[model samples]
Target: MSDNTTHPERCRCCGTMAVHRRLLDQDPGYARRRSRIEEHAFRAMRGTIVQRPGCTRIPVVVHVVYNTDEQNISREQIDSQIEILNEDFRKANADISTVPAPFAPVAADARLLFALAASDPDGNPTDGITRTRTDVSGFVDDDKVKADASGGKDAWPADEYLNIWVCPLSGGLLGYAQFPGGPAATDGVVVTYTGFGNMGTARAPFDLGRTTTHEIGHWLNLFHIWGDDGTGCSGSDFVDDTPNQGGANLGKPTFPKVSCDNGPDGDMFMNYMDYVDDDTMVMFTEGQVARMQACLDGPRSAIGEMVSCTPLHPKALPKDTPKEFTKEPIKDPPKERPKDNPKEFVKEPVKESVKEGPKDLIKDGIKDGGKELPKDNPKDFGKDPGLEPGKWKPLDPPPKQIFEVPTKQLVEGPVGGKQAFENPLPGGWGNQPVQPMQPMQPAQPLQPFVLATGQAPSGASLKPPVADGGGEQDQSQALLGEYAQLLAQYAQLYQQGMLDQQGMLAWQQAWAAYVQLGGR
Candidate 1:
């Protein structure tokens, strides 16, 4: 029999709690570690323990285990997911505005940033993505996906890297995560390929990169908002701010959804821990943030203490090179050769030859053989045939301007000859005297400009005068208004998850038309 739980079609199901239970039964040390971790979290939840100030940057390594080409996702998809994580964790997501007003004040910025590791655990440069070809068709929550022996990629060191496995998942499971205090080898989160990111094979209702966000929340020690109680009102997620709820809120539940006598402001279905659709869930509560910080400060403290997202400089040395070479400085070669060496040079003859010089040797050769030597310059070398002695000629100068205005004419006005007035005005004002005209008295201050209630004022029309090309200008303005309206509608539909593929294509076509019509 399969260990996976069968869920209703289209329901959001996670295997984390079940896996946690199984681990508790299988490993006693894990239970002890869990107890310690929960104690730290409790202290953090109260005012006893304090979290480190400022943001914590964690390095991530994505292992892409694929049985087929589609299962092997692209680096772009991986990067998109990372970007989403950064935005969501920092409360920088654009859809945070969708969080209801009642819960908005408690929506916390986790102040955590996740980036793909730029260097592997071995200190080699990496893009932080690993691709493994596996014989297994699909993976489940059995931890087989965390080991190479079982046809999956083994993880990097858990203390230095957050290992995330993306592969084909069976049993309709979207994803699962190993919470803090888990065994090191099987640490980190596993997300199904289709539900991992917003692009590539990611499907709707689960797309928008929320599955990884939800799984990472679990990895950071957050519980499901519904407390994993399966409709029991008594269970708690251990966060005081979050309301006590019966079970996971599937699909998209409207605001003020009453459950477990939690009314007025009911279940915060929009929290990241809830099992809502990607578009529906948009926030993390302050209590959840505190719990995650506690995990970072306790069981996962080592990973957060240092950042390994930057590439290591001067990557690992070649395997064949001696390890001592890196530690010791190389000595200079010997200054002098041994006298008795077989390959010793005949330096005396070389010194004599250098003193004799090439000019002396050339002269002696010419005198002895009486052979005529070639002239220094080769005949006709670089000499243009047309430029020889009497054949030399110069080309005529370029033609002068067709007509030149006289200097006096240029200095004078356009009419030529002389200025209209000999005494031109000062400051280059042509011919008119510099007159100091009297300033007119300010127009009688219009009677306070106040009107009685509902009284009309007597005045000239305030409408602006139409200039030349006003009709075309008006038409263009109207088109601009229409373009703006279309853009606004496009953005609204996109944010609200109402636009389909065809609708997007139509919007693109309309945008192209607007650009062609000279709309900005």
Candidate 2:
């Protein structure tokens, strides 16, 4: 009908007609079927038919094609686009308040919401995101970006999933979309990576993820507000309520923009379907919402009817559960099981002794340099308390992987050229002259408990205790082992709600009384 030329300045969605032309060229009966659906939708839009009640949730799948690290956008960016869609479609955007007072009453919510598909076409679980690495530098509006053979991914079933392609678009084209009734493999929208979302590569003037909003509006069978005619007064988007505008508005225009002899409130440039900047566009007129409703009821009804089987995230467990009680993969980025490896499919049986061991106790203290000491007898730690290691294991304890409390430092420092003690009485001297304290270095990783034997100029030099000789060392080592057991027992008792502050102190006094009487 019109010139059918490309416009790279504002958008490149004019290629939808080109796709229609190709479909017409290849299929003999396709045009008839497409026209029938379109005619029915148009008739419904004009009140010859009624639209379906209630909102529809469209399942969306985002296909990310990248040639470089910068092009592979983050999940946050993808989520940002989805949020914008839901906000704009449901008339819930924060900026909905910005619509000019005259147009506020005319602005309508389309009653549509979008969600990343929970399951794929074949009923496989998915995050609704597919990432593909490509060698092709960039793409134009040629639709090559829709095919895996052409360095892009093939679309999922169009009747089931709304496939969105995010990649580097050349020629300053913000985005484009195929209207309903196009070929399934090439259906959906393509957005330039830079204009795809609100963050990352998303730049100024197009950074609000509104490019995706505009493109999805096209996907839902909406035409440009100015109707694609080049600056002429005689253009029709085929909707009644939208004021007839001479041409597309580019930037933010003030209220009461006059055009096409429509006075007072002329161009509805704030509409998403218009060519205005992302921040400038705000509302979709009620008539536009009706037209979109007709398309959903007629051509795209299959998509809305497909039931989503996405599972909800499970609620978190109670905070009292010990972390070691929960199972976890031993390796990061869990390695795939080997085909011939015996351990691949077979799970090691949990030893009964380890399973029934005292609640929060580690069976053995960690060895020096992170190695686990080999058991002299497999059942010694579990069966016999008499044979327990008399000395604290010389190694640094295992990295505090279990849920011990986070360590807090008392960090005494100088404030305003004077040292401020949190507890002035504990330092035992009032008005004592001390050197100005320097800023503390960052806390180091947790280390095993060491005895303070010598004082250095800056701080204490604590060394791991060594066993020298007979009864004294034995008694000291035995006391340390007893203390370790007390800690483990106390942790378990506390977790069971049997011990609070006073209860814990009473247990400690009883243990000390037993130790002093040599009752081990």
Candidate 2 residues lying further than 4 Å off, grouped into runs, are: 1-30, 305-520
Cα lDDT tens digits, model 1, 1-520, are 1222444346677888878877777886676566557656754564335578878899999999999999999998999899889888888787888888998989988888888998998899999999999999999999899999999999999998999999998887888999888899999999999898789988888888998999999999887887765777755566768988877888889998998999888999999898888999889988899899889988888895443323211113345467667544443323333434434446666666787877798988878655444443345454656465443322221223112333343234234344312212234333333232222223522211110011111121111123455765575556545554554454444434556765554455444434434544
Q: Residue 148 of model 2: what lDDT?
A: 95
Return the top candidate by lDDT: 1
Clashes of each: 0, 0
lDDT minimum window of 10 residues, candidate 1:
447-456
Best by TM-score: 1
What's model 2's TM-score? 0.56
* Per-model TM-score versus the true fold: 0.58, 0.56
Could you tell me the lDDT of residue 214 within candidate 2?
84
lDDT by residue for model 2 (59-170), tens? 9999999999999999999998998887788787778888888789879888887899999878999999999999998887778999999999999999888899999877
